[model samples]
Structure formats: structure tokens, C-alpha cells
Target: MENVSVLEERKDFILYKQNGCSGNGMRCDANSVSGAVSQRACVYCGARVVLNPITDAFHIVHGPIGCASYTWDIRGSLSSGEDLYRNSFSTDLRESDIIFGGEKRLTAAIEEIATKHQPKLIFVYATCIVGVIGDDVDAVCKTMSKKYQIRVIPVKSPGFSGNKSVGYKMACNAIMELIKSEKPAKRKGVNILGDFNLAGEMWIIKDYLKRIGISVISGFTGDSNYENLLESPAATLNVVQCAGSSTYLANRMEEEMGIPFIKVSFFGIEDTTSSLIRIAEALQDEEARQKAIAFTKEETSKITPLVERYKKNLTGKKAAIYVGGGFKAISLIRQFDFLGVETVVVGTQTGKKEDYDIIESLVSKDTVILDDANPAELEKFMKEKQADILVGGVKERPLAYKLGIAFCDHNHERKHPLSGFDGMINFVKEINGSINNPVWKYMEESL
Candidate 1:
């Protein structure tokens, strides 16, 4: 690791080799720099990631067409029932509307869509210009809710207000408004949080919970509908998977409804086994706990041989991770460990200080830990670390290729589910395919 001078403008944004270089923890959860080409998305992107999986909600972007178009069905969250959430609706505000007021058009768009679709819930997202023009999105949503007698939620996600983490809090606030259960019936169930059910990952986890005699009352938004979200208060506990997006929601639920929450990850065999046992023990169900232990033994026996085969081929490989949140990055480090891979360089877009603390504690002393890293910083760190593979989202794939490094897609666009027993297998297969490719041999010699 090398010490690089930070620009006066970006002094608070970039950190230099914080893994073992400094006693102070890395700074995180701040607004991205103006011209840094940061991989972090806008506030609206954060809102959409958490709320767009409502299977039957009419998600209308209350701004220009670009915002709606860019986020239309962006996630791979599948629906078990209605596919209404897949469609992107926009008010399509133009230059004239921006100069004037777009509230009237927004109201009309809501009325038109509600009449045609007859959806039970609607989510209106405000964009950058909507924030600039000071549109009364909340007032319009209130009026529309009264007019249609359906829940019309307003997500105040102005692009420049803060980072994506701000948008996640805003989305949680909107959901709190929709909860109508005052005295929910107590049941032996749990609410799944943070997972967006990408490629049916939530379904896989739900099935496992069912086998352990626990019912899943609702998912945060993944494959979840309006009715399921309304029933969330009835559950006894909350099992949070993606802590970055759902921790706020879980904390609010505990405060408002008196339901406790526990953070868990099902990304690797070690995590998945522990999470199942933890969930069962939290409920004090002796039968469920025994079943969970039995389930882990069976599943591990089936998956370990496949993982061991891949581990033999992938021993001592070094990996670099750059993802949206800290939980995924932490899980990836463990997932890589199963295959004998070392995470040399790791960074996150909106990871909190606590997440960075755990990340710093887990990796080797020489590994690089950074926050809100730009493309130039990522390139420099990966090359300096001599990373064999880069595990990141779509944006970093091209950069890895240009450097003759292997790349893996661990973001929302990936069709394969990377969760539970099935996900562990997928994780190893993806790493083996990327790092052990035949073309790398030729490229190495040519370089």
C-alpha cells in the first residue's frame, strides 16, 4: 500500500491504505465529490433499490423521462404474482413544465394511471429537478390518496440531497406511513428485510425458514405486495439480510411495533448455517433449532464437495471487491475464503463506519480499505495489490478487463442468485470461471 496525497477539495472523501496505515477509522457515509466520477448513484437510485420490488405498486417517477427510463426494471427482482412493478411510469416533465409548475401534470398522471391500472398502492419518486423546482410532491400524493382511497406514497429522493443511503432512509419513512396495523395478531413468523429477491434468492431463503417451522410474513419489498407489507407488524421478529438498506426499516419497526431484529447473511455456508441457527434460537423453539442443525448438516454435506473441487483450482488467488454496501463486501470476503481466495483491495460506495470496522478487522494487514472510491483510485489499488480478479458491479467490469484482470458480476444485474446453499455453489463457479479462464494464459504471455 502507498500513501497518496488527497486533493484539497476531496480531503474528506478519499482515504489512503487505512487497513493498517492509521489508527483512525476511514471516513464514510458522506456526499460524493462533484466531479470525481464516483460509482455511487443518486438519491433516487437508493430509493428505487429498496422500494421497486413491490410487485403490485405503480412506481411513477415525478420528474423528467430520463430518471424513469434509467431505473425501469433495473433490478432483477422477480414477482410471484402481479408483474406490475416491472413497468416504469413517469410524469415526463419538460423544459416548459420545469419553468412553470409540474404539480398539475403529476396529479393528472397519478389519476390516469390509477384509473387504468387499478393498483392498490402507488409510489411517486421525486428527481433532481423536482427538488430544484420545489414541487409539492407530498401534497399531490396526499390529494391523490384521498381521491382514489388507495395508498399513494411519496419518496422524496432528490438526487443531490445526499448519497444513496439518504434515499434508503427516505424510502423507509414512506413505508412507515403505509403501515395500518395497530394491534397486529401475534404469530410465529419473521419479516425478511434487505433482500430484493434477486433471481428468487428471497424465495430460496423463505423455503429454508419454512422447513425450520418459521413462517415469513413479508419481505421488505422483494416479491412483496401491498397486502404482505401491511401484514409485517404481525410478525414476532425481523431477519435482516442486506443491513445497509433495511437496518433503518428494522430499527423503525422495533421502535414503532415492538418487534426485534437480528442481522443475518446467507451468502456463504458459514454465514447461512449460523444465521439459521440464530433465527431458531431467537424464537426459543427447540424443535426448530434441532431441525435447523439437521438442515445445515445435510446441505453442507451436499455443497462442500463441489466447493472443495473449486477450491483446489482457486487456491491462493487474490480478489478485489467494490460494491454498493458493506454487508455484501463482508460476505464476499468470506465467500472468497471458502475458495482460498484473498481479498487484497476492498471498497464500498456507502458503507458505514461500523461496517468498515468489521471489514478492517477481517482482512490482512496489507489489504487496502477505502470509501467512495473513484475509477482512478480503484485502478491504482488493484494494480498495486496485484489482484487476480475484481468482484464488482457493471461499472467496474470494463476497467478490470482493460487491465487484463478477470471480473465477476456481483450486483443486481446478475441472473443467478448468490444466496444460501445454491449461492455458495454459484459463487465458486463464477470465481473459477473468471480467474481460471484459458484466455488469461495468453493475455499474461502477451502482456
Candidate 2:
């Protein structure tokens, strides 16, 4: 609407700047436009993010070294046990392999890693070139599985195939292969899906659930090892935190294993309280429900006073969001609301129609909602909205700084935990620190 100099094809990718524009809903979940510089990561990135948290798995990038190098230890998923998932393995495919086939080289790489590590599980990710060169990654994985008597999962995540959401589904499919359990759920248990234990956030949630008489069968991947994943089918229900990545896995588990799922978020006080209650209600555990209510009250009481202090300085601040998924954007909107910050522009790399619908309903009428946004689009919307702060991943941080806007790290690589009551306090601290920093005054004076 605002004659932004975006490619004609990308015009539909941006909205809500025109006169009387509501920005309620716009197109989303489509592949990134060619040469648009979209913030969306590759399909392999999606797969890697979802599966890379398995603490004992040997993750192999079946392509060039760049893919593995860039994604190596990309997430701050802390492990309580095995730290094997931290290493990045790759075939380092060259022009020669692209011309012929990298299957042989892939076999050799798997063999090499298997011989040394003797890992029980290995996830082999197919990159863009592997898809182009027609490497049978599944066959290679299958052969290696038999040879080593391990689970060699093939993640068919060609970067060019689709956007990050496609990669999430790809990762979920691969994880589904490893979930094989015939025994019924023995304990009052649930599988935590999509919370990748970033900064031990998963551990925090697990502790709260334990106090409420629930046992965590396993996290979808965060701190979850091969054995934990194999036992995931035994859980009675699945609690999905990051819906964009783990929804498919939850649905599949429900259908195949008869394990029902409930979407939950632990990002803020409101979501955390409600999510705990939802889990208890789903399990029909009155004692757990009571404990969850008591815990919510106790936790909120301790943090509310501190959070209000930060809110006093942060109130009326406008923010922009460009994150990986829709659920996080939705949670941030509510979290910001709790802090009295208005989200003027929000977008996701791979949010679905339903996600956008919920996001539109949550924001103000004139707020912009975009899908698969490029840096230019983010800059234009953030500037147009006069936003004071931007919450995004590493890639978007520099852009926010160059624009003289405050930034917060809400992505995979963030070391600080941003979940539960403690996370709400952290969130407030981050906002207050960024928005009230003294450097901005100098920046404004110089500008």
C-alpha cells in the first residue's frame, strides 16, 4: 500500500500501510519469491531445528560444508546428558559429487561417524544440491541402519523444495520414524513437543509439570536422546509448544499411536498458567489441576511486582516482530500486551493461514501481518509503524540496529531462557534494557 520499492511479485507479501488498510490477513506459507531475500531459512534448516536437539543423535548434513558449518550448534538447546548433538557432520559435497552422485560419499561419511561414535541414531539431512543431484538419501540411510543396527533417519529437506514450514514437516516425518513403542503409557506422562530446551527452558517446564504430578516422557527433541524418542509413543498425550514445527508430529502421533495432543505455550505468564491448566484438564487429574492453579498464583505473585517495575518504563512502547513461526508471534503479542507494549507490525517466516487468522484477531486493526517477509519489508513496516523495538533472530538484529531501533533476541541461538514465570521476568528485563538503553539517545542526537 505504501509505494515500497519491493519487487512487483513481492507486493502481495507486504500489507497494511495504505489508507484504511486493516492488515487483518494476507497471503502466507507460500515459497519465498526468487531473489526476494526473504527471512525464511531453508527446508534443511527447518528439519535441522526440529531434530538437532536430540542429544545423542549424529546429525549429518548431506551436502556441502557450508550447510553444516552455518547450522552447527545454531540452537542454544542445552542438554542434561549426552552432548553429541552439538557436532555437525557433512559429506562436504563438491562439484564432482554434484556431477556424479554423493550417495557413495554419504555412505562413507556415515560409516566414518558410526565407527567412531557408535551412535544409536543418526539423522542424515538432504540439502538443495542433494535433491538436485538425485541422491537416494533414504536408501543410503536404510543401508547404514542395517549395517550398524541403528536408526539412520533420512530427512528429505531440500532447501529449494519449500520454505521453513515444509522443513518442519520434513523433520517431524523423520522423528515419526524413530517413535516405535507398543507399551501403553505407564505413568501420568506427556511428551513435550516443540520446546527445544533453549537455555534449559524445557527443563523449567518439566520441573513445573513434575510438581503437578505429571512426568515428561520426552521433549520432542530438546535434551531428548535416541532412547527418549523411541519411548515417545508411550506418552498418553502430547503438549505442543511451537506449533509451527511440531503440530504435524502431534497430529501424526494422535492418529498412529492414539496419543492425543494439546497446544501449549510457556513464553509468558498468561500462556504458561493456561498451558499448565490445559495439560491438567486434559489428563483429568484434579490434584494436578489444583497444584497447577496454586503454582500459577505463587509464580505470578513473585514476578508481577518485578514485571510491573519494568512495565512502568516500557509501557506505550511500540514494537515490531519478525520471527520464524506464528505461534511465537502470537505468544509475543500477548506477552507484549502484558508489558503494555503495542505490536505494530508482525510477521513470520512460515506461519499458516490459521496462525495468521489468530494473529490478526489478537493485534490492533491497523497492525501489519505478513508472511515470509524480506528484510526490506521488515524495515519498511517497522519504520512506517514508528516501532521502538524489534524482536527477531540473529539475521534481523543488525537491520534493527542500522535503523536505530532497539532489538531483542527471540530466536534459536538465544542463551537466556524465555519461558514460564522466570521467562516473563526475563522478557521484561530484555525489553526494558533495550528500549531504555542510553545508546539510543546518542543515536538520536547524532541522527
Candidate 3:
């Protein structure tokens, strides 16, 4: 809750003890301050990360090669069927193409991919260069779609358009365009939204749903394929996991298709249990609801002992959290609390007012809550708080180590699943190992 001096322009973006209680909300969902070296990604990167997980979709970045290269395999999304989404394709537009317009080159790229791969769907991303050059990507997509007799969707994601949140909306709009249909008869199933299946987390959640007698019609993008998405309209309800990326899609489906959505988080045991029960209740399935309760009880009993053992060593340690979405930050706060560790500092990239409100209520009054924080801000807060560990994405890993604080990877590129009952164990084990690692002691001794 202590106040720290920051750049004059970034003062409103950071929250601490005085302002945290003033009922003055944190500033978010806005463009990053100039020259702050903000950690937030661009609009094109956001759109690519959200849509590239569809197993069977062909993705083309209609701009320079660097845009495509940076976002290649952006999400650690595993596929059960097709691997086409893993390849980063681009028109490789050059000075000549930009000057003359890259429409023809884009058309050729789509034609080549369609001719060789014969894909069912394709997404063309417009980067800043394409936006500047006045390329009509939408018209090109329509012509190519008719020519190939396939769905060629243009993602209107220019990097200069807005921040990552805008890109999430753009990707959601593209998905809505791809899956729109005459109302289909509803079935006894749910569509999982917002989870990118990083580290096979989607598979883990699907298995739990199956055990509870609930069928998953589709995953929003993670491990989902063309067929899965095409059948999504038939689902009875939607359970949104990553609200940051998929909430807009859910809202569109509800408005256009009459499928209601409920936000759910599967990160920690507490949320996973509640979300499963809520899904069953939303479907009016009493039998499945009872099954969900039984599973929660069973899983909690099985995992609580192991977590308690780790807590013996971890209790009273403090943590700093900086993640992509508000839901993940909220879940991590609870997870750390369960382990008897206190979260002293927390921030999010795209969290809204409501998300921050929940976070504010959950953490202690002294806890620092920030939005769209840059590396300098994170380091200052973590150091001031004397955090024992920092839970964040790849971007923050080096920062944590350079400050001699233990680090945990809780982002998309992680190789381990961090959802459901199984994930609770993995998360606790990682936290215990990272915090108790011997290297920190050696560094201190040498210092």
C-alpha cells in the first residue's frame, strides 16, 4: 500500500493503499503510455494468438514477415487432428508490394494455400503495413472464398488499430462470421470458451466435464477444429473460461443464436469445483449437478493433504502476480492464499473494472493492484514488497531472476497443465520447488 514514485503520465495507471480505498478505479482498457516500454502486445499479436489455435484453419498474415514470425506458434495450443495452424504463412510483402498494393499478392497466397492444402477455412490478418497501404483484405477474402468454395475470412486486425483487447474483439468477430448459421436444434452440451488449451489444459477440463456427464460441443479455439466449431450452435450453454478473449464471442452467440454463457475459471480447485457445479445447474441437470458435487468433494479430499504439506514450507511467504487476464490473476491470488502465501502485489494486462474490483476485495488492503504495468513498474513494486516469488508470463521471467526473486511461468507458453484438480498439484509443486530452490541461497551467500 506504500506509494512509489513513477513517471508523471503513468501515475493514474498504478494503484496502491491510498487510492485503493478511495473507490477511484484503476485505469485500464486504454492505449499504453508512450515510451513506457509497455509489456502489452499489439493488436495483430492479440488476434493471431486467439485464432491460431483452430486446428484446421489456414492463417495468413497479409503484411511483412516479421509480424507473422513474432506470433508464430503464439499459443502452445495442441491439436488432435490437423497441424496446419502451426505453420506461419505470409505474403512476405516487400517495398514494391506495399507501394503497388498487396491485394494481388494476398490473392495469390490464398490461392496457393487453398490449392495445395485444400483447407476448409482460412483467416487473413491485416497488419499495420497492410492497413497503411489501403489493402481491401475483406474483398479479397470474399473473392477467394467464392473461387475456392471455402470460407476465407479476413481478420481486420491492424496493429495500430488498438491494444490487445481490440484484437481480441476482432478475433471474436472473425469467429462469429465463420460460425454464423440458421438456428440449430439445441442439445445437452456446453461450449468451452477463452481457454487456449495451453499445456493440454483444455483436454483436462473436457475430461472433467465428461466425467460429470456433460458433453463439450466445442472449445472456443484451443484444440478445437472446423467440425467442432461448426457444431457449436447446437450446444445448450456456453462456459467461458478466458473472459478477456472469448466473452465477446459468447455475447455474440447469445444474441444471434440464443445460447447463454456463464463465465467460469478452472485454474484452482475452488473455482473448478464451483464452475462445474454452476454449469450443471445452468443446464438444469440435477443428476449432473450431484455428480459435480461428488467429484469436487473427491478431488478436494485427494489434493488437500499434498497442498498442506507444501504449505508447511510456503506459508507466510509473499508473492507478486502479473498475468494476462483478470480471471487468471484472481485465481492465482486464491491459489496462493490456499498455500498460505500472501499476494502482496498484483496486476493485469487487460482486466476491466469489475475484475479489478473483485481482486481489490480479495487481496489485503495493503496489496498493490495495477493495470497494464511495464517492466520498470513491476520491478519497483516487487522489490519494494520484498516478494519471495513472482508468478507471471515469459516476459517477466528474466525480471524476476534479475531481482533474485523466485519465478513461476503461468502463461500460454507453459509446458504443464495448470487447470482442474491435477493442475492444483502441479501448481503447488512448482511453487514449492521454485521458492525453495537452493540457487537463491547461493546467490545470497556470494553477495
Query: What is the Cα-based lDDT of residue 218 in candidate 1?
Result: 91
Candidate 2: stretches off by over 4 Å: 17-24, 181-186
- lDDT winner, 1 or 3: 3
Best by lDDT: 3
Tell me the RMSD of model 2 versus the true structure: 1.9
Can you list the residue pairs that collide in candidate 3?
none
Better by TM-score, candidate 3 or 1: 3
Distance (Å) between predicted and true CA of 126, model 2? Answer: 1.4
What is the per-residue lDDT of model 3 for residues 254-327, given as tens digits with 9 covering 90 to 100?
Answer: 99998999999998989999999999999999999999999999999999999899899999999999998999
What TM-score number comes out for model 2?
Answer: 0.96
Question: What would the TM-scores of all predictions be?
Answer: 0.97, 0.96, 0.98
lDDT for each candidate structure: 0.89, 0.89, 0.91
Sorted by TM-score (best first), the order is 3, 1, 2
Candidate 1: segments with Cα more than 4 A from true spot: 1-23, 180-182
